[model samples]
Target: MKAFVFPGQGSQFVGMGKDLYETSPLAKELFDKADAILGFKITEIMFAGTDEQLKETKVTQPAVFLHSVISALCMGEAFEPSMVAGHSLGEFSALVASGALSFEDGLRLVAARANAMQKACEANPGTMAAIIGLSDEHVEEICKEVSVGGKVVIPANYNCPGQLVISGDVEAVDAACEKLKEAGAKRALPLKVGGAFHSPLMQPAQEELQEAIEKTGFNTPKCPVYQNVDAKPHTDPTEIKQNLIAQLTSSVRWTASVQHMIADGADDFTECGPGKALQGMIGRIDRNVALHGIA
Candidate 1:
């Protein structure tokens, strides 16, 4: 079976999706629609903007989503997937690709999510760090140990074997990194991010985005979407919505999600997004599967 995946925030770059926009009429139309719907010339920013401009949360989220979903859509008959999954913001892309959400609705939701997350970051400052060459249990235990007295940190993204990302308050995250390094982790590198995503600090963003999500309609997707919250495949609309609502504050179980897809007979994996991060993670997760990229 074929499993199509989408990448998250850090996958974006300058001139992303410009090639498709110029080469495919459908992609151009969609890009135009995105610009109008976003109330800005997002296409110009995506096509010719500088790195700093594209790094804005609002632009990065939507730009990556557009590149990912449009790439899959432009594939026409070749974009078939028995199952799909995405990392963080890319979940919206996967939802749109699998027919669970309309293109316009997906874009609107991504915009809303980006704004909400940005506000949450401003309201409560925090950050994330990457812990490499450590067991997940060791990192989790260290996070739990350091998180105390209103300082919250947790294992956020389980990227692949021996690699995990943790998110939380700045002080708590710093303390956790110290402990993780002392616990024999090969490297504990802090990520350059505005806030702690997929952690308790995003509770405000979760609450705010929930209203928008509940109000939006979701159709049953063409294929099951392995969600990030629990790394489980969901096909029901209500369940999918609920998972999405919870996703902002839950861990992104990417490693488990890929494992489940392979266990379920997904030997072919295609990453539909701007960067090759997901492909690299999937390759580390299991080297036997064939991997491809569309970006």
Candidate 2:
């Protein structure tokens, strides 16, 4: 029972895939193909660009995806998964690794998703915040209360116990942070993200990406993928496509997904991505489960 997990967004760094590029010719070929597909030298930015440059939404998403998918590919026969799951943008990586989507199509969709999300952010200025030391119920209730009179705020990521991220309008999120802190939260910290992803504010991005997703072809996956939107295992291409499209404006149920995986016999989790963030979260979710990281 091994589950291969992929990380998203914040997992990226300046020199993320340089070691893979330098060590494996297969990795180099994929990196070169990525540059051509993206119409730019993304590998250069990933290996030597400034942190500020890597932080750009368009660069961050695809860079992380490339690292994750390429790492899994380089594993060759060793990269077997009973189940797969990803956090946010990493879902695209999971699909590619599991054979649900081709490498080229996954990269294209990820680039499209990033550009669409960036456009949505510019069109509607919003933000996200981390709420620590609060129960999920309390956070959800407070978010609902704060989301009134056109203010749209909601829980976005259920990372682990006592840790959740909320996203929405800037003012609403700030206000929610204050209220959450006042309600005995250990820390209510704002995240340095481009916009309120996984919230109603991303509806425009969802609409824009839906077309790209529907147009892309999907195949039956080699293994089940635990989708972000529903925290459920999906093998059907049609269902996976629908869930991926909904993920743009839906919460990432990481906690539930991990729990479900564990209950369904996922005794080990290998994080194949730029950072060990998913490993840490999976550790928090269940200490008994074995955890490993490829990057």
Local accuracy of candidate 2 as per-residue lDDT tens digits, 102-168: 9999999999999999999999999999999999999999999999899989999999999999999
Indicate the worst ten consecutive residues by lDDT in candidate 1.
10-19
User: Which residue runs of candidate 1 sit more than 4 Å off their true CA positions?
Assistant: none
Which pairs clash in the backbone of model 2?
A: none
lDDT of 1 by residue, 226-285 (tens): 999989999999999999999999999999999999999999999998989999999999
Candidate 2 TM-score versus the reference: 0.99
Candidate 1 has a TM-score of 0.99
Among all windows of ten consecutive residues in candidate 2, which has the lowest summed lDDT?
A: 273-282
Output the lDDT of residue 256, model 1.
Answer: 98
Most accurate candidate by lDDT? 1
Cα lDDT listed for each candidate? 0.96, 0.96
